[model samples]
Target: MPTPGVDRWTFGVAPLAQTVELAARLRRVTGLALSLEHAAPELDALLDALAEAERRLAPLASADPAPRVGAAVDGDGRVYLDHSRHIGAFNPGFPEYEIVVDGDQATGTVNFPVAYEGPPGLVHGGFLALFFDAAIQHHNCDAGVAGKTAGLELRYRRPTPVLTDLRFVLTRSLDGGRIRSTGELLAGDVRLCEARMDAVQGDRARLPPVSPRREQPGPV
Candidate 1:
């Protein structure tokens, strides 16, 4: 069985925050590299050199790293401001978006870059769902409803455009520890997609919590 309270994919908050910035820069590099993949063959040498450098650094980078902690987690086990997989933060796998909450509603605005394209000049359908899911989760969190995503449904009304600013809005209501939420993605006034999410709020005691370490141990 897997060890309790351990998520290898997640990192310590401080280190992850620094890595999040690095990931953002790496994301830009990725976009440029993809754009240039079809260009002159001479660039292959440069890409090869870059890849070799990364290969050499990978092992040293992760060797004996500090243990991961739950610093960004709350008393109720909610992870906030975790930039790695928390799409709400500045992680580049998901569109970088900002949210503003007013009462039970949360509105977000983001721009899809060319890297997120599926069809020519259109945002990928899967990314659209991710955008809505993150937005709805943010809404639930801001409304003081701590929960996990139980189920989600999305409708693609039209192809979402890439390389343009888009807006997303979500709202949630709690009923018997379950949050029923809905959201919409819009390009200007045109609705591109809509989504519904079911989140189940449970007691924190059900989880095995990990506390943050304040001091690092000496190397053996």
Candidate 2:
């Protein structure tokens, strides 16, 4: 049996894993089909199952764990971790993005999987942009703005490989009611992309309520 907070193979209802396996199998079978007609039905069924699984996992996938950054805010409007670990541990995998803040600077990292591949084994450019967007938002939050993306621009330098670590570094250029930030994504020593963003603090009344997810328990 798996300990608390560690993802383990459960006896039943391993929805995400099951769905991932099924999708992989479908992709393989469809690719090897002798004719287009032979693959269509299996492809259609795979798409339907994948869509349903994603719908069920969306909410859980979107939930943001109350980050432990010194300035982090919890779902109940409380501060959690006063200091955060490195970006890798901060945000593990999937559509999630992780930020590690130090003073006015932050770093983000995301590990793309085969599911997020774009060209062959490369990470999708759209997803790379999403990571930059989210990283900038987290940097803004660290700077005490509590705002959303008002504007963002990205320049892709090279293809980011799926299953490789993509790192982003953000520095606050301006802060106040409106925040201006600059950042970049690196694959190893090579620069993959660069970005800048502006975020304006929205009316508190118009802002959606925040409910932070609970942190997973660490090794004892």
Candidate 3:
């Protein structure tokens, strides 16, 4: 079952999976572009090729991203694109991570690519916060419940390195009708960051249902 207020698809969605993979490759190219150096000497040809690709694609797609937001398509229970998901199964700019859930507990791994660097080879604190929020919500959804983020708090212990596999674990519990979750990022035995989040379990029944037939939304 898809988590309330968070998940829209549960993988295996036709074309959805394929598009996500393409987005990932796009991310990889962007990361490489950011880390390119003069020593590589291949940047000119790369940039030219990329520009040509963009020009070819420019007419096929819109520059505005709002269409994807709240857009609906039939898939695993009618996929609705929620660009805010930090896991970036769809969005290319968000932090990328893989998570696994077992009941209320979940564990995941993330490697902050070069494009996410902040203070000298370290992952940005802002991005780490985003990762935790997404991971926590992901756990909630997988646990058969979910909601909007009411509050999130993160503590940075040691600098989180970019391009290194970091482990994160989160546990969720119910506090009255609200959901509470806590998680940590670890570098081997060393703790890198910790997070505590609170979310209001919104009534999924009250949430708007997907409208798959609507065309792309335009400005009013």
Every model's TM-score: 0.74, 0.52, 0.76
Q: CA lDDT of 110 in candidate 1?
A: 84
**CA lDDT for candidate 2:** 0.59
In model 1, which regions exceed 4 Å deviation?
Answer: 1-17, 37-53, 60-90, 211-220
Locate the minimum summed-lDDT window of 10 residues in model 3: 67-76
Q: Cα lDDT of all candidates, in order?
A: 0.68, 0.59, 0.74
lDDT of 2 by residue, 1-220 (tens): 1232232111111223454565545544543552265447776886798799789977644266543233443333332321112222222232445677775688877776665667888878887777776666655555544455788888888888876777878887555676787888888779988888887765544533333435765889
lDDT of 1 at 19: 56
Backbone clashes in model 3, listed as residue pairs: none
Ordered from best to worst lDDT, the candidate numbers read 3, 1, 2
Give per-candidate clash totals. Answer: 0, 2, 0
lDDT of 3 by residue, 104-215 (tens): 7888898988878899999999989888887787677667677889999999999999999999889888888899999999999899999999999767566554434235
Number of the top TM-score candidate: 3
Q: Which pairs in model 1 have colliding backbones?
A: none
Every model's Cα RMSD, please?
7.8, 11.8, 6.1
